[model samples]
Target: MDTPSSSARVCGERPFYDLHAEAYDLIINDPVKPWCDAVDAQLARSSSILDAGCGTGRHAAEMIARGHVVDLADAAPRLLAQAAARCPSARTQLIDICLLPTADHDAVMCRGVLNDMVSDGERAAAIASLARSLRAGGKLFLDVREAEASRERADGEPRTRSGFTSRTTWDNGLLRVRETYAMGGDVVEYQFTMRPWSVGSLTGLLRDNGLRNVSVGGGVGRRTPDRLFVVAF
Candidate 1:
């Protein structure tokens, strides 16, 4: 998958989420466990859950073990391979976020994504779709690095590394990728930009998108305000 160029303010249709599925999975391992653990408690266990952008099926594997009927969606065939391996019984599909509608899931989880990419109109439409997909009181969780925070973290050089996400014949959750970091600082900037979003702005998005009972909370484990929670019908 690809993402928009760094020079633009709005993101184009770059599906970078699946580009380095293994690296993405490693990133998830760092920040996702705690946040998702919280999510496991926030949403009912054993319910139908959707893991949008389930690169390498890391989240899906956990959900399956937790007894969720998980539907994993992504646009990368390679990543889907990883997902299929991780949760052989999971319902998997190669799909784009903009093409899917909501309401079939009790909860949807798309982390370390969404905020970093997605055009404004696209974000609005996606949020609406997510809300539409939820049953009354269903929840959605997403994560993003704040633009303001990105400035603080920017090293002014886009970190690049050489690695690949490959699919093996064995349908098991085996993956490997060399992780790279994008340099950012207080003066850094990005095209698909984001800002440090308070719980209020996030809740506003949720409420504006037809979601209610919104909650803005910080995450544990990582020193980043990575998780944002929302609920809707």
Candidate 2:
């Protein structure tokens, strides 16, 4: 389900919300830590922010801790629940970004969601949907995998996860997705889904959606290009 291409309501790749929301953070570390830190440093104060693909509410919690009014929205119901648990005051929504409602936030944030959808068309649509949620001059933040970077992690500690397990096996071009779970109102069965996306392609898509001042920032690990940003209308 690449962006600007596939339909979440139709593709059936498992709604993220229904996935292991309760255990996402336990499985994944701060995938885009640098970006979060940047967001903390450079964002409108007391603004309304939307954590678009807020997985397990990690970033949302960070934003709330910083005093930003946050709306934790995601396609996964279970994930939203977890986010709510982390920040009970945050307004949570179970929304598939590709099919989001009308609203313009002061700022928006999304990470690790669009890349899962493997089609460019679907990815584009999803971003466009996110753009619509932003008001004029509302900044948007998102991160996708850098197509050119290799996923070769140095030999070190053993990595593990819940619900699904993934490993970087391609010389530097594939993300290995494996595992399945049927709970939280959905079923997730996936493995060996490779994604090839580049920074240039992402910038083009953002411009197509009328976003200005798009930029790419540091990713989760200091070693990787984890995210791209779109300062929206």
Candidate 3:
């Protein structure tokens, strides 16, 4: 849902969140506890965690509530501000997933972000960067919108929030969503392109990046199986 323009890369996706940061929580009401449970269950030890693209810092706050040391990172400074307010104790960093800092983390989580990479190269680079952020034997938990599910959603109803209306359409393997927002007298249109990766393909990507024990399952605490949560060590 956060994919950027071809010319601008992931950095281009920041404006959407920055503009909609105040209404982000209202639009996206997914509970964070289940994801926290899933991450906790897979952790061999809970010494430290890196929450990549930690929008609003809910995940980091949940992890911190569980007594795990947390580092919250995101490309959007506006979102990072919100995250900092939510989890005051977390170490906040302005980071890009494709160029994560070298650190040995017990677990690294990147939920609902991989699909944001519109190209294969960006996805590979992001996965490799996350792998580098992990220590040996550390687990990585990531989730992406399944390709089939994206195709199915193309036929669903459109959603609207904070003067913005969004509708999805699928062409070939790309999932495209067009959002139109009413900003006072001006109307702005934001179009995002995401490549939905299947579980098999995602598993291959993780293993190719030197990550092992990759497994894919339904998204944590979500009734719809559209999101595939992948765990690798």
Going through the candidates in order, what is the number of backbone clashes in each? 17, 24, 0
Per-residue lDDT of 138-213 in model 2, one digit per residue for the tens?
A: 8877766666553444222234444443444453355554555545566566554546557777778878888867
Residue-level lDDT tens digits of model 1 in 1-233:
15322212121222234333445454444544665576687767698888876777766787788788888877667777888888888888776665566456888877644553334565555566556666777777766444344444443433343332221111111111122333222122222233334455556767897676665444444654434444334
How do the residues 1-233 of candidate 3 rate in per-residue lDDT, one tens digit apiece? 24432423543353357775676676566888888888887665456999998888888898888889999988777888999999988898887787787889998998777887777778777888889999988889887889998798776368876677888888899887787777555577888887888888888888997886988887786656678888898
Best by lDDT: 3
Q: Candidate 3: list runs displaced more than 4 Å.
A: 1-16, 44-46, 183-187
**What TM-score number comes out for model 1?**
0.69
Find the number of clashing residue pairs for candidate 1. Answer: 17
Q: Is candidate 1 or candidate 3 better by TM-score?
A: 3
> CA lDDT of 198 in candidate 3?
86
User: What TM-score does candidate 3 get on C-alpha atoms?
Assistant: 0.89
Runs with alpha carbons beyond 4 Å of true place in candidate 2:
1-20, 31-33, 150-165, 168-176, 180-189, 192-194, 220-233
Candidate 3 local Cα displacement, residue 92, angstroms: 1.8
Query: Candidate 3 — number of clashing residue pairs?
Result: 0
